[model samples]
Target: MMQKEWTTCFPFLNQMPDDERRRFLQSAVPHQLYAGEVVVREHSKCVGVVFVLSGELKVYKVSESGREVALYSVFPGEAALLTVNCMVAQETPVADVSLAAMQESLIAIIPSSAFFYLYSVSPQLQQFIFSCMYKKFNAIIDLVEKMTFKNVSERLYEYIRENTGSGRIPLYTTHAQLAARLGTSREVVTRCLKKMQRAGFLQTERGKISLLEKPEP
Candidate 1:
């Protein structure tokens, strides 16, 4: 029954015939994570693939100076396949996984050996893998473009615009956290925020930032 629940969370598996779904489910092992747990880490051996049945996970990389730059956030019904690649290639993981639970969560762990076998035999699984890889690849490309060509202010603006549906973005982050997200120093972020505040673009008080302008395109 738990296996059925795990399979249901994966959209790719939903279309599969029952027999095939059962085969896929047989390859997975159940696992649980607590809030604030490190599910994976940089330079660590990857054990298997993770299917998040519940909860959220933040995928990030730590800088040499020990700063975390968040890459993406994963929630229930999403899976992380990078760990499978690492185990298959016998290489260390490139990022760290931090579990953030709004509530308790469960996951299905599929061992690398079983995953490889499934990939070899299942055409549907292959297509799913390909689609996932393509999306991840495109995301990395987008990140590169942002880091290389976009200024910190632009990035911050984009971040704010993306997160807030309305023109007014009520900021709920500290200056330091904003700096990390912008890939700049806290002083720089503070300076930019001050400038924007003066221009009526936004305002900040007690670590809260609010966007006053709709942000220019």
Candidate 2:
């Protein structure tokens, strides 16, 4: 029987026919990730697709100066299929990113060859891949827009709003992390944050941040 938690992470898998799901699951090899471990490295030959079964993974790219810029994060059920795409195309990844486990995690890896064979034989699998790709593309578009049009403060606010979902963004990240996401220096982020705080837009405490007012859209 498929675990209830697994269904929550992979709702689509729950809808699949039992036999199909079983077969697909069989193709996935399980592995463990310790906290702070790198699950994947950019430009490394992708051998398979990896799906997080538990915990959180931070996907980040290194800037030219070697600063880490966080791209996004993936939790349970989210598969890093872009790596598989790179492998299939035999192309080097454009970004130098790594997947670091924020907590202990379990991952399921499916070989690229097996995935291709299964995708060819199963229309459902193909549809799933396309849908995932579409969403990934949209996310990339959103990121590009933010990076291009928004200032550092605006970008930081947008990220906080989206991640918190409740207007109140907890300030757990370091200033250095914020700087990377903002494409600036830690001092710059610190100065901007202080300015915002003085303007009554936000309040920052020890490792915590509260949004005091919504920025004008």
Candidate 3:
């Protein structure tokens, strides 16, 4: 996106002080990424703050056996806290999480020093950080609960319901992606998905899956 478009997405940038705004703009580098591109790899240190200006990003965790569980996703207008965490804490952040482009994406990269400076001086930015952090924390906690307590079928059902909210939109994803998000094998997900298709809970065709009806309580 152009400077005008980026500023429009973040209107507060127009209100920032001259020096602060200059520093912010100077540090905010742009990156264009393709689908499946990993933004932050497992065990890698933060280079800078990353936020999506367009498209989507999937942040996930991988297990020892090569399974993956989604942490959360960063969409247009959402700021990722991974790099921010590193800047604020000073201590080394965990590198187990990976952030990848879910589709064609436009990301703005901000320097850590500039991020810290703005974080200290801009109340609006600070408020935004706090709000984003709170949300990210709750999501991680929910993921932990699912991993610990929910059975695979139950988790798969939950994932389907959550992603295809209101049951109107067909889930635009593949079995492999679902398996990665669920931290299970593709065969396991495919088996269960086939079972779901037979049971009238869902239908799969091509690359998308659509929920058929709400499950019984």
Candidate 4:
């Protein structure tokens, strides 16, 4: 019964043999995190592969200057690849790689030893992990290109378009959170957002942003 739920969220688990599946499921543990809670910290030991069963996780790295630059987000049915990398390499991440709950979240942790054993024998698990790596690698490349070539306003507008898939964006985060995601300061994000608002590009309300005009793609 419970196994069905985990396999539903992580379909790859369904491909495992009964023994391996039972072992893995028996070892995996679930945790709940409140919004704004920091779950993984810099230099902390890699605990296990984190599978988000519900809600969102933000993956970011902190700089020496106390700035945070978001790498990507982990949604339901997704795993945190950085944690997988760290666990595989058996090394503490040096770039201050961090993970936090962007909202109230329910996540499961597959113990490192169990994950390592399963990864060795489960081709399905390997495929899923590598697939995640490939997709996230491209996203990081895109972020780097934007940071290198695009101006702040252009980057911010691009972010808006990406998130506003339905032409409206729920204000799920604060200006500071936006800055971290955009690799900029809160003040810069605020100024750019205000400028966009004045330009009639969007309408900012208490908990949402409504697009008045869509940018030329």
lDDT of 4 by residue, 1-217 (tens): 3888889988988888999888888888989999989878877878788888999998998889999999889988888887887776645433248899999999989888899998999898899888888888898999899999999998987787768864555444577878999999989988998999988787777556666675564
Model 3 scores a TM of 0.87
TM-score for each model: 0.77, 0.81, 0.87, 0.91
Pick by TM-score: which candidate is best?
Answer: 4
Relative to the true structure, candidate 2 has a C-alpha RMSD (angstroms) of 3.2
- Model 3 C-alpha lDDT per residue in residues 1-217, reported as the tens digit of each score: 5668867777667777778777777788899999999988877888788878899898887888777878888877678887676555556664557889989999999877778788789876777667778888888888888879997888998889888894788898888898877778889999999998888899898888899895584
After TM-score superposition, what is the CA distance of residue 163 in candidate 1 from its true location, in Å?
Answer: 0.3
The stretch of ten residues in a row with the least summed lDDT in candidate 4 is 87-96
Instruction: Supply candidate 1's per-residue lDDT for 178.
Output: 73
lDDT (Cα, tens digit) per residue for candidate 1, span 158-179: 8776765545457677887777
Q: Which candidate number maximizes lDDT?
A: 4
Pairs that clash in candidate 3: 43-95
- Arranged by lDDT with the best first, the candidates are 4, 3, 2, 1
Tell me which residue pairs clash in candidate 1.
171-209
The reply for model 3, stretches above 4 Å from the true place, is: 88-94, 214-217
